[model samples]
Target: MTHLKVGDKAPDFSALDEQGNRVSLSDYKGKKLVVFFYPKASTPGCTAEACNLNDNYQRFQSLGYEIIGVSADSAKRQANFKTKYGFQYPLLADEDKAVIEAFGVWGPKKFMGKEYDGIHRTTFIIDENAVITDVISKVKTKAHSEQILGD
Candidate 1:
C-alpha cells in the first residue's frame, strides 16, 4: 500500500508508456488522474483490473478522470498487453521501478505462503492540482471501476 494518503502531494515522476514515448505525472498536472500500480502486465488479475477500467473508460472520461496503469513490465510487454485487451488508456512501462518506488507501491508481498518483494496493486486518485484524493489499497480487480466510481 502507498505511504502517501489523501491530500498528500503525489511525487512527480516520468517513464515510458507502452509505445516507448515519454510520459510524466506533470503531463496530467491540470487534470484528474487515476494512477494505478500493479505487479505485472497481462496477468489474470492485472488484466481484469485493466479491462474493467477500459470497459468504463468513457465513464471515467465523462467524470473528468484520466487513467494510467503502471507496472514493471517492458515496453514491448506493455504494448502487447494493451493491444490484447484493447485498452484505451496508457500503461506505463516502469521497468526501472521509478514510479513504483515514488508511489511506495514496491515492497514486501506474500503469495501462497511465500514472501518476496513486489509491487502492490494500488490506485491513487489525484485531483486537478496533483494532490491525492483517494487511495485504493484493496482493489477489487473485476469491479475496479465500480470500486473507484461506486454504484
Candidate 2:
C-alpha cells in the first residue's frame, strides 16, 4: 500500500523511459498526469491494465490527462513491451527502483501464499500543479480507465 494520499504532494522523480530518454516530474509541470506503477512488464495483469489505458488513450487525452507506466523492468524490456502493445505514452524503465521507491510503491507483497518484496501496483492522478488528486490502490486491470475516469 502507498503512504501517499489524495492531497499529498507527488514525489519528484527522474528516470529513463523505454527509449532511454530522461523523464522527470517537472517535465509534466503543466499537465494532468496519470502515473501507474505495476509489478512488472509483460505480465498478464500489467498488460491488461496498460492496454486498457491505451485503448482509451484518446479519451484521456481529450480530458487533459497524460499517462505514463512504470516498472522495475530494464530499458530493453520496457521498449519491447511498449512496441508490442503499441502504447502511445512513455513507459519508464525504473531498473534501479528510484522512481518506484520515491513513490513508496515498492514494499512487501504476497502471491499464492508466498511472501516477497515487490512493486505494488498503484496509480496516482496528479493535477497540473503536481498535487495528487487520487490514489488507486486496488486497481481493476481491465476496467482501469473507467476507474480513473470515475465512470
* Superposition error at 18 for model 1 (Å): 0.7
| Whole-model alpha-carbon lDDT for candidate 2 | 0.96
Model 1 whole-model lDDT (C-alpha atoms): 0.93
Q: How far is candidate 1 from the true structure (C-alpha RMSD, Å)?
A: 0.7
TM-score of 2: 0.98
Q: Give the TM-score of candidate 1.
A: 0.98
Give model 2 RMSD, 1 decimal.
0.6
Candidate 1 lDDT over residue span 16-97, tens digit each:
9999889988999789999999888888999899999999999999999999999999999999999999999999999899
Total backbone collisions for each predicted model:
0, 0
Poorest 10 consecutive residues by lDDT, candidate 1: 1-10
What's each prediction's TM-score? 0.98, 0.98
Error of 1 at 121 (Å): 0.4
The C-alpha lDDT values of all candidates are 0.93, 0.96
